[model samples]
Target: MVRISGEAVELANEGSLPAQEVPQTSITRSQAVKLYISHALSTWNARGYEFATILFTASAYPDTLVAAAIRMTIVYFAMILFSSVVGRWVQKSPNRLRTLLATIFVNRASVLAGAFFWLLILSQEDLIGSEGRFSLAKNDTLKHILFVVAMSFGIIERLSASGNLISMERDWVVTVAAPSGRPYDLTHLNAVMRRIDLVCKLISPILISVVISALDSVRIGVVYTALTSMVSIPIEAISARRVWDDNPSLRVPKEVPPEGETPPLQSGTMSWRTQLRQYLHDSKMYFSTTVWIPSMALAMLYFNVITWRATFITYLINVGYSLNTITIARTIGSLFEISSTVATPRGVEYLGKSYRSVPQDEHESEVGLVSGEDSQSVRDTRTLVGLQRFGLWGFTWQVFNTAPVVVALFAITAPRVQDGGINVFASRMVDRAADYTLPAPPVGWSIVLFSFLAISRFGVWIYDLTTQQLTQTLVPSHQRSSFAGVETSMMNIVQLFAGGAAIAYPKTDQFVYLASASFVVVVLSWLMYASWVYRQRGHLVHWEKLGQGLFVGGR
Candidate 1:
């Protein structure tokens, strides 16, 4: 029997069989709520712009995805286990305020630490990229080893914390809405806001670079970029508090209930586990009708595209530069700020709000449905955020590789094109936009090849969200962390394997082929999401299905 969730795609699968009335609603909420959600999802441009630049300029060969994945999994599991042990230590003390204060302090510290860590990570990457002469000194080897290790740890921590910080935005938006006034559920206005957020994300880096260029140096931009993480942490942290502690929706009064009365428990008592359980239980309703099938499978496929292309860039870059010989205080600024820039167009609500605070009024439907400011936001955010998961990895590798791609493509496509950053960089100007124009690179359809890579990735983003949500909905909450952990671990594995492929290939062509494998896997993964998820919509299959699909496709 056909199910409800996947009905949209299933109907599409019939391929123009007949035009039947498919019911959809418009005018679900006020313009403001839609605006907020759209803003939050708008980071694609910022991230994509960075990827464009990185791909255009990149130079490193990739590492082994298998090795990197395994290492990352091990580290994360260890950290999770450790957090369980130490979280209590930090939370100690009977006073709830004090406990919250302590937790907030750690939260603040993480953001600060993240900034510095991020700086170091970017600097190391720049070192290997900018260092010329293509040397492999003893020092270079040591630095390479250290750079990988640092990046692994640094990214893990940065990403993990960053995820939580972003989540606060989801949670806080729910906390602040006015009661009795619910926003419409699916407004295009939300999408419009998302576009704005992206504008900010894309333009900020170039703006920062312009300032640095004015000084004829990259270091000032880098330092300023790194230091700004300090500002971001607090802003986001308070936003988180608002959601957790201050949200009117989640807030509970301390007054004792009457003997005949009952009230909702405060968030202090409810757990992520409980929230997770309820989510899973409700997901059973839509398992058969999931629309995420194509998008999910595509995501895995796109990851592969990025692997070989970006990795090849990294390997070549490392070969030419010694880690310590190069400096990149400017790039760090571009890295983190880009997210904020992208997020702006996605949602104005995301822009003005922080993840810590939630002051939204709770509007409970007479029937028992809990839909409000954040719920719709969360739903849309989950759907769109997948577009950006690769921002860090893709942006760093791709934008950094831009010069070479242009040169290579120009070489192949326009055979006589001279290769070099100055030349290739200058050619990037559609208008005399870049006053400090570089020389042009000969031949290789650099633009065409890179465009294919980006378009494929964008398709994957659209696919992953639908499937991820459906899967998350079907699974139980207690199992989500483990599920999430496994999924995350698998992604790490993919990256590790890509890295290995980058190194093993004797030539760039072979490496690119290896990268194609990622896309192949992604396509296959989506097929499964669509077919299997559609087939089992109304019943529970072996939880084992998930094990096989965990890392099937991702970017």
Candidate 2:
């Protein structure tokens, strides 16, 4: 049996009522707490590897923007190539626990291998050079070869890590939270998971950057990452195993084929053309769904080169900013993002309360639905309406909040007369600012730039959480990871373009162009999201009422 409720479809057994009619097993408070803790540990370990890789690129090749671009582009390309494959594998896997553990093992092993390769590169560098700079000896060929090998390992690591993320964040969290007879658990779980991610993102980079900058040796940073990742493997595994053992529902595979599509034939028996056709059909399936708008909007945000990312960090280092200074500014931005995670749940709760307080007949009359519908379906409709409203609200805020970043870039990079003021110390750079021994920005202007960037993260994360939850709540179970993997690939494709832009304008003075281009993409993303909201307005709560409730109410 199938039931439709305001853009979402629920399926059940042929003889049974809709799945929403069945009594769900409620999770104990202890079990909920354990899930949150396990998710935090696993997310922290995953983000450790992610941030460590960024630090590796930014620190190891501080003076070479082109080298950093190449390495980052390679990682993005690897995700584009392998995310879908990993997604399909996870969808077909019978044992989620074994699949998750094996994926983590591969990710950890690749990190260790990359570290070994980086050690080789460090060995080839001359130790008697300038502080915090890696000057190679006459053997350029050997160094290039070692760089390629390290990036190869990086590709493998990113592939497996991307797979792990899709499995956990996209699939398992929803599966575990939805059937627990609690509507708010999914939102709370997403918020806490993202909070843990932000926390790790803030700490790992700072620690790695401080180690490399203070010690003046990239080798030490590499060793520290390798050792910590080695220790974290067992801990992450154990936490994940506990969650899996306690939730028997997670073990049962969800394999409902998508409506209107035939099941795929055996891979070994299909011809190459048949496989190609199947792949195209799958692509169309994703694009045809309502979820694609949010997916594409989020992906468009990645075509940004001027954000607080690896390329921008590399640019800051090249422009004479100290690594310690860069990490401190990023930590400030992360704090705002962490707060956004907290704010998101409150916003969700506010919307839920407002929607639930509406009279059923009034809601049904406004939307042209029957008055005597099942109460569960009515609840489901209200939930969908709330998600859609919040998604639109978040997007609207993001559009306005991101505009300041472009202005900040233009102000910081403007050509002006050299002023005699407090000089910020430079850590890594070749072209020191004229009239100053070290390349440093005027202290006041530097703060403004960092402040604009930091504040923008508040809106960015609110939108991120809303869009992610909307996708999680709406997408079908069988296609969750596959859809998420494609979504990841799309975002990386845009990021690849951003990396290419950095390669084209590989100097600090030419950063304004990248910033302008990124803002234009942000506007375009807002338009796409706004259009989706307009199309779904019929099923959503009244826009004026929702706006008044969110903006005007003291509650």
Candidate 3:
């Protein structure tokens, strides 16, 4: 038995529905709005602080790009290694709200301490002997240690938060919304969340630029971080309590069945290995879809090449542009990203609606339903529908996957001429110059490039959302965290190799070419695998059906 909004109700038996309707346990619209606001605030503050810290560290370090890369690698590696344990703990915790709050506190505290230490180090430069100060500054081992500590705390916080969100969303879907016969509308919800995220991205760059320009010290950035953290901490704490109050079962620990008693079928008590095996067996299509990881890794390596080739800040300075100019450009790009994200779901919805309007014969073909005795028109309609769906998913994957490659290509091929002691380029076509420098490209070119990058970013977000929905569909509630951990761990393993490769050959054209070729091979392999899976499964590998089941229907 459990309490929902002060009403006593028995837990629904697995695979059965009671004759009487279960009172909705889903969060009210008001509660959801509040949760969204709180989450947005916390995420924005956390991400802003992180961005500021990275920028500050880059400014302080000599090889800024390499330092950033190494730090990011360390963070991802830590997440990969620790996520499984963290996930299991979250699932088993008696008081999940407390657990989540504690993690957030620790994460913020660690970052705050690191910021203070950084300021302390800078302040003590004159007090320390020249040799000692030089050693501290030159090696930067202390800074690295600080970053590792901060990032470790961040990993725990993020893992806890992810588990909490999934649990809440699951409860809302399975218990509340479905029973209440309401449309889930996941796409719309996602769009709302993403819109908030985009706003944060748009604002963060401007804020950082203003701070950096005004104070000319990284410490000021820390102030913003601290202030935001203070606000976010309380809001998160309040939200956690509200969640617990609304859903007491979430706060209770799972009880093991006594000896000689039959355990609940839905209990997620399988060994980690067994769970992983089962998940893989059930999600063969998903696994096939992820064959793009190696290609993604190669793309990441290509990205590093472009990033390190010429630091964006250095390039801007060399091009006779102010820091503010770069910030403005970035802010505009972020706006574009926001717009694209906001628009994409509408576009997809429109396409879905349009596709549904075909003749019944065509619709049956689109959905891969055909009889041996079907007419020629029906078969042709089916073929067209199949092609449409295939093209949609394929285009989506390519758009998301090709971003880094496009950036790399732009880095290598953008026209350039000599200017301000560095290579520069103009917007229009130009003759090859002895010195690699050119006049600033047309404003339109900059806008186009920025928009392209923004669209790519949006595509990545969509891809992530799609995969997350798929995972939520495939994994049971109790096993969600563990499954997420395993998936993240696998991805990190691939990224580790990619990061290592990039670090080993930081500046090499051959490496980029090799990576690109590897990406092409992996992509081709993925396509073949997808085709095979489609033939076997009779449908393209996608989350659309799952989405429909979860959102459109109670199931």
Candidate 4:
């Protein structure tokens, strides 16, 4: 017997398998409200602080591009290396909320430490001297020491921030939504959370840009960043605490024992070798799960280099597109992404409801059509069916929309390079009056690419939200963090490859090969995802029915 919102639903029994009970749990409207507020403030502060610190680092260093690259490398490496550690820690923790707070404190504290060290280095003005036309610091040893310490703390901050996000977004959100037993609530929450993130993504960088523009000294920007981080600590902490206390579900997670705790390996502590072995074991388990299909699909999408990425912006610039044109185009793309976040919940609900209306007899015959115990009860309830059905819909929709991007990528022709300092061009283009005049020549082609890219953002985010919800709902509670951590690392690993692709063909004229390679990668990703979707077709709502219901019936 299971109790959800005071209604009882008897679960069917499986032969030879022990049954698990569903507890009576509910998430009230007030709890949901507070959770949203807390999540919003916490995410905004973290993202803003991160963007500000990156901006400060870029401005502080003598070689801007190198600094940016190094910072990105450090951040991604930290995420890849430590995300699993945090996941395992959270997975085995007695108090998950405490773990969340621990991450937040460490993240904020590290920001402060990094900023302080940077300030020390920047304040040594007398030690700074000119090297050719550029101002270079002369106290090599002290400067190097400070720089290294600052970056080291930066690594710590990134590690903790990743953990914090894993806790709040990946772990807690699912935990909180579970009690309601409604996929719509889960979809709604996921959409709102993503909306917050996208909002920050759109606004935070621009604010950092403003701070960089207004401040005469890089040191001032560093100070401002430190202060902002300091302020966030209390706000994030207090709000997170309130959310935890208000929602009991968020506080209690089933504690799984730390891996490699056998008598031989567990003499109170394990060695590094044992830890590595344990991580590998966990990775193997994560990759073997049914959810890994969509996880890998999502990760592979990051491999496609066709979007409004920085590389694309540079390509446009090298091909004679004005910075204003690129900025406006990217902003338009972002707006479309934001719209997806807004629309995802409705999309999920629409599909969910339509799928629910299909006769049980229609779905019952094919339930458990997938070769796993997981899909056995897919039609036992509306919730179970909705999970995979909408996920497939969103996944297939995005892949269809990506067709335009493939065309856009192949549409781009080899560019004739333009000679100018990127920094000078960026600065002048930002303040320069907008040229409403129609773009001529190569710039026109770039616009076509940007237009298709903008349109695709809507589908991309819809797919993202659906896949996220699917992962959250399908994976068991205790394993969610571990799976998510490893999944994040996988995404970053693929991203590193994407970055390598850019490095391999960096010249403007070489973009054609890059584009060609990207197209191939996109096709590969689509094949993988499409094949999986096809395999699950028997377990899913008919595409013709779903389409007619969504667009024609407006249900």
Q: How much does candidate 4 score in TM-score?
A: 0.81
What tens digits encode model 4's per-residue C-alpha lDDT throughout 1-555?
111110111111210112233233456677667766766766776777677666556555756466667667767777776677667666666576788888878887888888888877776654233432224455758876877788888888777777777787666776666322354366677887888888877787677667767865666777777787787677767777777787766555554543453112234567778867766866885775666777887888787777766677667775557877777877898899889887766655455444332234532333321212242233333443454455556555655666665555445542222344233334344655743232244544555677767877787777778778666655655567788778888888887888888877776556767766766765676567556545544434464565576682454
lDDT of all the models against the reference? 0.35, 0.68, 0.47, 0.64
- Write model 2 residue lDDT over 297-334, tens digit each, in one string: 99999887757776688667755579779868887888
**Best by the lDDT measure:** 2
Which 10 residues in a row give candidate 4 its minimum summed lDDT?
A: 1-10
Candidate 1 residue-wise lDDT, 1-555, digit = tens? 112233333332321111132212222234244324322322322233233223212222233344344444454444433332222222122222233334434443543443343334334433345562333333435544544554444434434432332222222222222221134321222223333443555465556556556874333444554354344444434443443343333332212223322122234645767644433432322232233343234334434534224454443332232222212212332233334333323332321122112323221111011223355433333322222222222222333343343344324422222345233322433445644432232213534444443433333322333234333333222222223333333444455555455556644334445544544564456445546433533322225443532332321
Q: Considering TM-score, which of the candidate structures 3 and 4 is the better prediction for this target? A: 4
Top TM-score: which candidate number?
2
Candidate 2 Cα misplacement greater than 4 A, ranges: 1-6, 9-23, 54-63, 125-139, 178-184, 213-216, 256-279, 314-325, 356-379, 417-448, 539-555
Question: What TM-score would every model get versus the actual structure?
Answer: 0.46, 0.83, 0.64, 0.81
lDDT of 3 by residue, 15-80 (tens): 112324333344567555765665576567655765775765565564447667766777676656
Candidate 2: residue 4 Cα off by (Å): 10
TM-score-superior candidate, 1 or 4: 4
- In angstroms, how far off is 478's CA in candidate 4? 1.6
